[model samples]
Target chain A: MSTSIVPSERAADRGALAAPLDDGPRQREARAGRRRSATRIALGGALPILLIALWYAATAFDWVPAHKLPSPDAVIVAGIDLWERGLLGMHITISVQRVLLGFAIGAAAGLVIGAIVGLSRFADGVLAPTVGAVRAVPSLAWVPLLILYLGFGEDSKVTLVAIGALFPVYTTVAGALRHVDPHLVEMGRAYGYTRSRLLLTVQLPAVIPAIISGLRLALAQAWLFLVAAELVGSTMGLGFLLIESQGNLRYDRLFLAILALGVIGKTTDALIGIGERALLKRWG
Target chain B: MSLSQRTTTLESPALPVSLRGVGRSFGSGRKELPTTVLRDVDLDVTAGEIVALIGPSGCGKSTLLRQISGLDTPTAGSITIDDRSIAPADQRCAMAFQEPRLLPWRTAARNVQLGLARGLDRARGAERVAELLELVHLSHARDQRPREISGGMAQRVSLARALARGPGVLLLDEPFGALDALTRLSMQDLLVDIHAAEPTTIVFVTHDVDEALILADRVVLLGSEPDLPGATIRRVISVPGSRPRDRADAELGELRAELLDGLGVPSHHSHH
Candidate 1:
């Protein structure tokens, strides 16, 4: 009985060893993963396509008045009109510039202040309550104060967007740094790593995922505050286009501006998403 | 051969560790009462010696190892390596924790390089890391992340990382406590082989009596008396064998029974 069982087990073992010679399962898994992502992309686009079709049908049938809801073609024509006049490019470029500048300045300040507060109990105790109270004030309330100090030019608008970008990054970074695995930090200390070296080698790497998420949230916030900044007072931006088109009773141009805002916001978000994936692959 | 003969034969780079009246207590704040963990502990480990610290649960064996590694300060006395007082994270010592504590993002080779002395040149550091990885039988896993490896393999990486420092004293705090029984036995043999290859002063904490007998030249038992507030050295037994002793030797069996009895567990002979 033992001899028969051993022979069968050896055959099974040989079969298992021979299976991977062709790399069968691994290739199958890669194909399956590609198929799954393809399916995901199709599913994500399905709703948008259906909604566009419904809009076209509604307009073609005169279901909603054209004055209130312009046809998709009309919005496209308005966009082309603005592009021909050079207004569309200036608006997009100015808006993107404001968002990027505000995000860079605010995220940098957040990271530095967050590191200080996270690593030092004294700083946290002294600064936390005041920062919390400041954050509690509605972001819109900062609009008047920023304009009062920096005037109605690009400075006031950029400063408002910077305030919007700061808090999320500060909160997430400070919280993440506070909770970086204490065991790993202890190991770093055991290896004679000095304080700053320990922070760089262990603590910062451990919190890279949190930092990226914080940056993503801050980017979204920067866009929100940019609209607020431009809506209050400005000459050239998608937000200014919103007020202008509405005042002139050009609903198609208003729709064009809204669509432009959505596309640009999503495009910036996807850019950060790409960076997130790469950073996680390296550090996660 | 006896331990003395073996020690005298090798020109060891290992450092001797001396603990004099060492003690530790926690929670000395105004709002909290002080709790003593270790008190009045003293031991002198010779260079190139393998000493195993064995004790019951919560007996401060790990805390004592920390004091020697300079990862924690003793509230009472002093610990010196090679006749010099230990500093915080002293360069003379390296430690492998119970959990491996490898940086999850770094490959096995990079994690081991973390142990290299701060100012060492790049080429020598890389060479040292490669050699240590080979020593721990993990050269094949040099590029694998900690999460990609098994627990036993990660522990081996941890050991390799500790050895990369070329420390005069190596400290281990139950480094094999999390591994399976078979893996634990193999790791014990690997450790013996490592010591033979590059003899260093090793102080390890373990709860396994048989493991202590198999590896240590001297086994130091720590425990607390009924009236004492904290644990201290209760007995220091010198095993009668050289490196890599037979696990089933009669002398070791008797000694194991005695050690078990000292730890408040009944031996098989005692039951009979």
Candidate 2:
């Protein structure tokens, strides 16, 4: 690319030129900005550290009863103990497995539903209202109905997670399709794409960023709902461990379980985000 | 290429679009309150003819293009494409609007491939995509998303997409109007070259008089508000030769003057 811009230029000539290729001060400011943002990100990261430190201090000084609040070290010890017992590993695996299963089911169903709702007027007319009404009801509300119908087992929990997970995928797809530039749709139409090709290629791809967002939300819900669904009805999974700990009033273990859930959720969300950035790089 | 040169017989070919006394009214049919968008719109876009539609905004220029592309039907007349009556799912004619409209989830190359199905097999589709990306000078940004490119580059990819299926007719609605002058000029040159090489029937719409004069074999201007009942055949300017059609020529200036006056803008407004 051409670099450097000569100054003896009038505005008209400058307009004729593309935005300047190079500027010394501009480059310096850009470097300064990179440094500033990097510093800010580093500094901002410490707030969490400070919060943990405060939590430790409050516990160390006995500001609250040990039963009421577990110290950071106590939770860490509990995490280590649970890991040593093989409880943490097994529960994490089960939760991950459950999230993956429910996510796949919900996301697939949601994608199909989204394409239909986005593409077909008849399909949308038939399904959108029903999906809308169903979405209004939280996935937790279905627990009672599922338990009564299928009883407290893995099926109910998985099903609940799937139900919880489905709406976001459905909504993201629908909204994305709705908002997809008519410009692109027109481009698709002009290219002589058949109906199926239009949907699978143009329609589906156009709505994917939307679908990806839904998948992330669905994953979170899938993980979160797994815990809630596992709470009363299960002998396995992290929620069972948490509930069991709560009953015994082993506050440190409860804190550790809760922390583990947060950590897992955050990590999984970050991974999905990574997947999205990768896809955007390739596709976008 | 002229309309008469090409062989347009398809396996299931029928009359493309023959608008018989086709006119459009924008409001309710009751009373005289309906705003007439088009009147006595008698025109037939053949299987392979690039007919440029030029007019002022709100003169139903876009509406006319939409009718031909099957986005809507004329209020009073019928329309067709590839012999079939116009429907929402009709695929005879492809269109690209002013915006690039690339799917953010697909790469620039894949965005162009959105139109390559049925007619183009896998290998050929890949070849067409490569050729089109090259044509648009965007293979370097082929892996980038729409957000990563400039407005002009996105529009180029959009053009590539429109050309992907070897469409019977290609419809463009102010496709390059969004770009800067230099970008617009380059895109115009690229469009002319692609049109020449591929020989696809192209109907390019734009408000720029120079753009219409430069790219189209025939420029059909849509008349304005208070154009009033009877159809106005507002000058069909023809300038056929090569790229960068002589901007200073007397014939072009005369035509530009008349068009600007009809559109109620001063002739000086043409350049800006």
Candidate 3:
């Protein structure tokens, strides 16, 4: 890629000044964003750096017990130990499976109900008010009631995750239909489309972006609720490890559990974002 | 409100559409705050004739075209199309807009085929689509997605689509206004050729006077909202000489000047 042999004068000038060569439009945009993100991340590290400095200072001055606030070095050791023990993978797998299953059930139920509500005044009148009311009640509020029905088991966790996942799906579908462009629908009518065909073709195509957005939010929420639900006397989950480690004063292990949660959550979130970008490229 | 109710008011022959003293004001039962978009309008559009509508921006030309397409009804005066009030089953009119609004996900052939949905059985649909692609000289690009084609090609496909329904009337709302000069001229010539072959009745709306003079059988000018004859200026500029009419022809230049003068737009901004 040396520019010494370049014939063009503009290229020679650009090369002499060391102006960075750019790729295609998409690659150029991605490189620009990557640089910005790197800069921001570097600047953001300063605050955390200061906090770590203060904590180290406080521990060195014997202001607090070392056991109480485990050294960052100890947390790193514990993280490596857990990684070797295979507990990290097992916990993550369980959480992800619960989230996916729960998300699937909620998405299907919510989509059906949302369509019914969107299309029919009768369904809206009968179901919307009740669902709205139920959605207002937090997942924690339902913990006691769910336990009564399904006991302190996977059933209760799945039910709670479903509860958390349902509202986004319902709102997105109903809102999308309500916002479906009338002009597009007019085009459909002019094309001699039947009522059902209008829904299948024009209406569904217009709603796809919103539908994908809803699915992403629901999946993320399901994971959030699954971990929260797992916190309730959970035997073998990241959340259970987190709670149990706290009681045993194994601060390093607790931090490791929390770190594992953050890492896995971040990875799943990134994957969802990547999926959204790829889907939007093809459809949006 | 119903087909039976509208029958009494729908008899006319010369103009396929005639709105007599039409006035429409939309509001939520609040007369004091009514949005009077069109008023006391009388217009006549003869069949198989291209009528170019020229006016200052925001003169309700698009709304008027919508009325002609039977997509909307006038609030006061009666609008009759082919001696029948516009109904849900009416399929005699088709429209093309500024952007070539082809379904992005569908192939070029499928988009043209969308217009022929009325009679398509699987194989026949594909065949009809192929025939239309040939008409637009887009046969080679039939299987390609809309994203794969240039702007001019997309527009040609859109025209083929509008013709797919066998529309007796074609309504174009600034269809080529978005194209570059070269592509625009190409499309204009293509449209003239297509119109000459089939004689599809058209209501072509453009701010370009030369465009109107070249394609229109008559150039009608509507004044600013709240002015009348409702159709303020009407000139029958017969496109009689031939296809590929010389742009330098004295008759065309004169008509273009008159159309620009009528619409009160300077020829320099539009003609060139």
lDDT against the true structure, each candidate? 0.90, 0.76, 0.75
Query: Compared with the true structure, what per-residue lDDT tens digits does model 3 show for residues A1-284?
Result: 66565578766666568646634688788889999999998997888799778877767776879888777778788877777898767877777777877888998887877777876678888988999999898777887778889998888888888888888988898878877776666777766765787788677767778877888888778877887888876777787887888788898888777777776777777787888888776656
Residue B113 of model 3, lDDT score: 78
Best by TM-score: 1
Candidate 3's residue-wise lDDT over B14-45, tens digit each?
A: 23766677765667465466666667677677
Ranking by TM-score: 1, 2, 3
Residue-level lDDT for B233 in candidate 2 = 44
**Residue B265 deviation, candidate 2, in Å?**
4.5
Please give the distance, in angstroms, between residue A166's alpha carbon in candidate 1 and its true position after superposition: 1.5
Pairs in steric clash, model 3:
none
Pairs with backbone N, CA or C atoms under 3 Å apart (clashes), candidate 1: none
Task: Specify the poorest-scoring 10-residue window by lDDT in model 1 chain A.
Answer: A17-26
Which regions of candidate 1 are displaced past 4 Å?
A: A1-30, B1-12, B30-33, B270-272
Q: In model 2, what lDDT does residue A103 have?
A: 78
Kindly list the per-residue Cα lDDT of model 2 for residues B154-268, writing each as its tens digit.
9998888877766666788899998999999888888877876677667778899887877777778777435376343466666656555776777777777876776678887
Q: What is the lDDT of residue B201 in candidate 3?
A: 79
Weakest 10 consecutive residues of candidate 3 chain A by summed lDDT: A15-24
